[model samples]
Structure formats: structure tokens, C-alpha cells
Target: MKKCLKKLELKIYHVVKGEKIDGVHAGVYGDVTGIWGDVTGIEGDVTGIRGDVTGIWGNVSGIRGGVTGIRGGVSGIRGDVTGIYGDVSGIEGDVTGICGDVTGIEGYVSGIYGDVSGIEGDVTGICGDVSGIEGYVSGIRGDVNDAKLTDNERLSGIDVSQLIKN
Candidate 1:
């Protein structure tokens, strides 16, 4: 019986041992498992994660634990989705994304469709509140402390800090 058709083709599919799969697109299939996993799919997104993934289409992202994807966007810190469309910035804990947008200092998010800036911390997003004073924002929009003081006041008005202090 040819070893039962190679054990029915390894149980119909789902073979990714040792784990590291990347960016699969066009037509899509199934069976994604994980251990030290990293997956990236484009167009027809399929992502399954135990740890570490970067997806596209459906969007996933992660870190410190592992998982990252974009185009639909996801982000994380304690692990799972590290910001692209759904932006996650980190320091403490509590991160959520479903239209994805979060920024951090202390951390706590229930909803984000975009824009929730950071400085002190307390984000409940629907686009607003751009922070300052230890601000390092992620995704959705911009401001990042007035774009780093307008690029250091446009290179210190061309004086260039007295030619770098001579």
C-alpha cells in the first residue's frame, strides 16, 4: 500500500518542523503550527502563532515573544504584533489591537483604530492625544514631539551649531 500513501501525505499537510516560514502568497493553503515560529503571508493571509510571526493582509506583529505583520497592521510588546497598522509602543503592559494603534509608557489599551500618543500613559484610541515629554510614538499618524523639534530646528538654522563647535 506504499506505506499507506506516505501516511496519507503526512496527514494531508502541515509540516513545518523547527519553524521559520516566510511570506507566502498566491492561492493560499493551510496547516500552520508553531514552536519558534515566524510566518509571513501576503494577499490571502493565514497566520498561526505559538510565538514569533510577521503577517501581511490580515496583519500581525510581535516582539520579546514574537509575531509581526502589516498592511492590516498589528503590534505588541510582551509578545505578539509589534506595530505597523496597529501601532504598539512599549514600556510596561496591556496591549490590544483591532484597527491597531497604541503608544506606551505605562500601558493599557482596550481599543484603537488609530492614534493614541504617549508620554505619561493611558491610551484609549479613536485618533487623538499626541503626547510629549519622553514621547516615542508608533504608527497611525505623526507628531513624535513635533517631529523631533522640526528636525532639530531645521539643523539649527544652518548654523549647524557653530560648525559642530569648531
Candidate 2:
């Protein structure tokens, strides 16, 4: 039997939704993420990454890094969160993540939505949609979405205000 070292690395834990990765099944990696180790990397790097509680939406992204180990078609390093969900916007009447690295802030929604507008790179720990490195969706209380940022309001390290604020 193979030692499915699911939680072998402390970097990624049960961050994925509905997944229970254990070192007793030895799984593969790929784009068909459905649970904790599925597409064990970014949230929406190419398609789907769901966690609900923002536990593990998008972490290390891009098909680049060192030693991407896992089961399934999910290959890529979620090692240091090279890239998380970036920033984006949603059109009127839109309630889903259109683009950028989207993660559920708080709620039991179906999927993150974004339409018409899209972005590139991670938006896990900074402000503005064009920020550099791990882009933050919302890390602070004063964080105003870039899409919704007003000339009078203050922005922490999060953009998408137009989608968040508006």
C-alpha cells in the first residue's frame, strides 16, 4: 500500500473543502480538485478551487516551483503561497467571482463570481488590483475594495472595491 502522505507537509492542511487528505491513500494532483488536496495550489489559477471559509481558497499558484507532490492531475507547488487569489470586479446583478484570485470572505455561497473584468497575479496581501505578490482579498477591517474605493475612504491592502464597495 502507498503511504498517502496527504498532510505530510505542514504548509497545507485541511484548507481544501470536503477533502480529508491522509498519508494512507497516496493520491495524485491535477485540475480536478474536489477536496482538501485537490489542485493543492491556488484557488482559481486555471479553473476551480473552493474552500468556503477562506481556509484554503488560493495559495501557491502558477505551474512553477519545487517538488509538487500529490495525487491526481494537480501538479504545482503550494509551498509558499507563491500566489493567492488576486483582485477583480463584478458587473451589476453579478454575484460570482468573474476573475482574479477570488475567495469566499464569509458565507456559504456556491462559487465566487466575477464578470466583464479580470486580473492577473495573486492579491493576497496588498492593495490595488495591480499589486505585487500574494494578493489579499480582504485582510483588514479598513480594507476597501479597489473597485469600491472612494476618494474619501481609506484602503488597507485590498482592492476590488468596486465589486466590494459598490
Candidate 3:
């Protein structure tokens, strides 16, 4: 009888909205109101984040740090950010930041308040003020309130899969 069946183990835990989850979480989340720690190896939509986060994959919102495969609004990023792909908007930063190629942007992109580098993308119906920039942006339509370009070049290329850890 034992040879006819195989053993299996399953663990399931649901994370509610506005609840606090600390340490590393490797699973799917929905409408996450707050995350007090880093989320690694995530393969689903992570939304409504209200804290500092890092190393997140898939469509993410309201977070920062080494992120990849992200498709959402990013604000207040404060480090070397690499390998970001997909549609994004409202990227506001305060320190040295780096970004990869973006597909398209629509709406407002206000206040890149620090040294930003390597942002390559196409913009449509966008308006805002950028304090400093050292990257490339093409196909811009709309208005830029204020901008300061330093070098305007591609810094380096990075792979999206390498930014995550198992």
C-alpha cells in the first residue's frame, strides 16, 4: 500500500491587508498595506506597500531597493537600482539612483530630487520637474517643469533574474 502512494506536505498562510510581516517572505501577496522587512522570490502582484522594501519581483508598488520585473509606481528610491522592466510611472527619488529601460509612461512624473542615472524609456502625456538627471529618455511628449542632464548615457546592463536569490 505504501508503494502505491507518495508522501506530500503542504503549508498555506494567508497575509491580510494592513498586517505586518517581518523577515523574508517567499510567496504571493495581495494588497499588502505594510511590509516591515525584505520580500524575496515573490511571484505575484504586491500592492499597497507602506514601508521600505527590497529585492521584490513581479508587479510591485510603493517600495524601494534592488528590484526586478516590476510594473508599477516607484517613489523615494535611495540606492543603486538596476534591472527594472515594464510599464511605470511617478518615479520620484531623493538620492543616487539607476534604472533600466521602461516601455511606456503616462501621467505625471514629478520631482527626481537627486542624482539620477541611466533611465531609458518612452514618455507620453507626462509632466513634471526633475532636479538632476544623468541618463537617457526618448520619445517625450508633454512638459518638463525643470530638468538638469549631466551625461545622458547608458551606464550598464543587468539581468533581471540575477537580482533575486533563492
Candidate 2 regions exceeding 4 Å error are 1-47, 50-53, 57-59, 63-87, 90-166
Q: In terms of lDDT, which candidate is stronger, 2 or 3?
A: 3
- Which residue pairs show backbone clashes in model 3? none
Runs of candidate 1 with Cα error greater than 4 angstroms are 1-43, 53-83, 91-166
State which candidate, 1 or 3, has the greater TM-score: 3
Question: What are the models' TM-scores?
Answer: 0.18, 0.14, 0.25
Candidate 2's residue-wise lDDT over 51-133, tens digit each? 33334454434533322222232223233432323332222343323333344333222223333233444445443244222
Error of 1 at 155 (Å): 25
Clashes of each: 22, 44, 0
Best by TM-score: 3
| Residue 162 of model 2, lDDT score | 29
Q: Candidates ranked by TM-score, best first?
A: 3, 1, 2
RMSD of 3: 17.4
Q: How many backbone clashes does candidate 1 have?
A: 22
Q: Ranking by lDDT, best first?
A: 3, 2, 1
Question: Candidate 3: worst 10 consecutive residues by lDDT?
Answer: 152-161
Provide the overall lDDT of each model, using Cα atoms, as 2-decimal numbers: 0.37, 0.37, 0.45
lDDT by residue for model 1 (1-166), tens: 3554443433534444543435633554554343343332234433453444344344234333321332333244333223333333332333233343334423333333344444233334435444342323233232223233445545657432322321
